[model samples]
Target: MDKLEGKLHKLEFYISLLLQMVDDTKYPFFKLVIENQLSEEEVTEVIELCKQTEIDFYVQKEQGWVIYEDLLAQFVGQLNSKLPVNQVIKSLYDQEMYSELMGEFLSIIAKHN
Candidate 1:
């Protein structure tokens, strides 16, 4: 479970980095949600769920960010698909913009949850 938790923590760290580029007002809320989500058992449960579902959860393994499943990933892909070519390029190349986008996505998830 140590390896799994390590991976989970890595994922969280990337998320925190992404959130950093978003509205400062959202940070505390985001931090709360992330902290709540990061318990050891929770990480293990998440990994088990991913395994049972056979989802390619990791989007960028080197960066330790996971998109969970293709359906969810496709949704994000769709969001990116609508962007102007230049904006898309910027989103790809600009960490802050990418973080802002991910933060917006996380905020939406937090709202519905």
Candidate 2:
């Protein structure tokens, strides 16, 4: 099932990307589970789990460098919400701060995994 496989791929991709952000941020551990035979419903459930586990950590921004702990916490909170994937992504992408950090984190994730 391409549709289901695609969703899994997307979830895996997002989990990996989010993990990358978490690794660099203050919250060392966050709830991120990668499922093999996941339906859309299950993926959303995992997202909700992640949201509740999100912690508000401090961050500092200086020049071109940003601490990103606060941004990562916000990202996790958004990630775990019950919102539709497209809607959640749209909101996240619209916010330039998270969007840019996500891009960098995704790039870093690609290299590592």
Candidate 3:
């Protein structure tokens, strides 16, 4: 089933991300991701998948990456069902940093399940 495969792919993508940096020594595990030594301990398999793109981009470009505009738009549309996610997403949108490394995340999901 396409849906099942898609979900699996998503899980795989997140896993790849978590296997990277699993520890940050700055933030106290309750603050923004920026205030610390980048790590992945706090990230979950699901959330990690969403951040795969960012991880890859940082390695390849040494710069931040953004998800495709169309994809980001679609994600936002889907986020409407969750008010809390929508709020955070909106904040990122306002900052023009909405992609937040999601492109690599999608790419990883498309790779292997």
Candidate 4:
């Protein structure tokens, strides 16, 4: 795969994983996919936005691209929960799942390349 193709695939895989991690019904991030209305252009735009912001977890919502931190905060706020997005991310890192996930992602990229 070429560089752009690899990046697109990575973004798609990341978004798919995000969908699995969150409650799609409650998150606007998954709306496009769930409603079968997602477009390639939008996906590309989302990827570009993430690259520009240096944040890999941006999601394409109806209003536009939203960072994962904001999405998680909104979700937690709505639920009146004490668990913040940073804490969740820190927990993942503390458990080493983040590293495992990154390793898997790199392996997948290598296989594609």
Candidate 5:
């Protein structure tokens, strides 16, 4: 495949992984959140992170898709350093903006598929 095709393939793989993580409840963090095992402070922090992520996404989106993806990856990396992967995913899944983010990703996949 050519460069653009290769990039799209990589992005598609990443998106699919993200979708799976969001849907799967097997992770300990998912179970903990569901069982109300997290402290109120922990829940508040996750929610704050999710809101910040959403805002950052929209800001980067205006710059263009490539920049958006780059910044998003960096932002998620930062989040991963502070939170478990499953917690980050769960927090993002709970956001009102999650569907909109997924819709954008799905449309991109549809175009390439």
Candidate 6:
């Protein structure tokens, strides 16, 4: 496959993996996949490609909660597939901004059916 084709194939595969992860009961294994398989550049591309339609779904329900919006942006900002999401969660917690709600949002995105 060509470069773009290769990228698209990987993207589709990862997206499917993410969907499967939502229903997966194993947190540790899910974290491993997120850390190892999901690349920042690739996820970034996915975000950019989906941003228009994605609409930060969680934010809309709250009539656009500013904090959630900021958190969402930050989380997406650091989408290095090599990095585990816990790192971002830790940073947010250290900054006194992390919340279950934020985690829920990320979970929703990752596992949104």
TM-score of each: 0.23, 0.25, 0.24, 0.27, 0.43, 0.27
Q: What's the C-alpha lDDT at position 27 in model 1?
A: 45
Candidate 3 structure quality by residue, lDDT tens digits, 1-113: 99999999998687657645544332223223333223454334324434553454555555543435444444445432323443334333333342544433335445544
Off by over 4 Å in 5: 1-36, 67-69, 78-97, 102-113
Candidate 4: list runs displaced more than 4 Å.
28-35, 39-113
For model 2, give the 10-residue run with minimal summed lDDT: 26-35
Off by over 4 Å in 1: 25-113
Model 1, CA-based lDDT: 0.44
Residue 3 shift from truth in candidate 4, angstroms: 0.7
Report, for all candidates in order, the number of backbone clashes: 0, 1, 7, 0, 0, 4
Model 5: ten consecutive residues of lowest lDDT:
88-97
State the lDDT of candidate 2 residue by residue for 4-98, as single tens digits: 99999998798878666653233321222222334567666654543332222122333344454445445545553433433333333343324
Per residue, candidate 6 scores C-alpha lDDT tens digits across 1-113 of: 59999999999898778766664333433344464566666655534533432345445546844444445565566555455555544433333332454455555556544
Top TM-score model: 5
Per-residue alpha-carbon lDDT of candidate 5 for residues 35-76, written as tens digits (9 for 90 to 100): 444566776665576567667777767766543445445445
Q: What are the C-alpha RMSDs, in order, of all predicted structures?
A: 15.2, 13.6, 16.2, 17.8, 16.6, 12.2
- Superposition TM-score, candidate 1 onto the true structure: 0.23
- Candidate 3 local lDDT, residue 7: 100
- Residue 48 lDDT, candidate 2, scale 0-100: 58
Pairwise lDDT winner, candidates 5 and 6? 5
Model 3 ranges off by over 4 Å: 1-46, 53-67, 77-80, 84-86, 90-113
Evaluate all candidate structures by whole-model CA lDDT and list the values in order. Answer: 0.44, 0.45, 0.43, 0.43, 0.54, 0.51
Screening candidate 2 with a backbone cut-off below 3 angstroms (N, C-alpha, C), the clashing residue pairs are: 47-80
Name model 6 segments beyond 4 Å from true.
Answer: 1-23, 28-66, 82-113
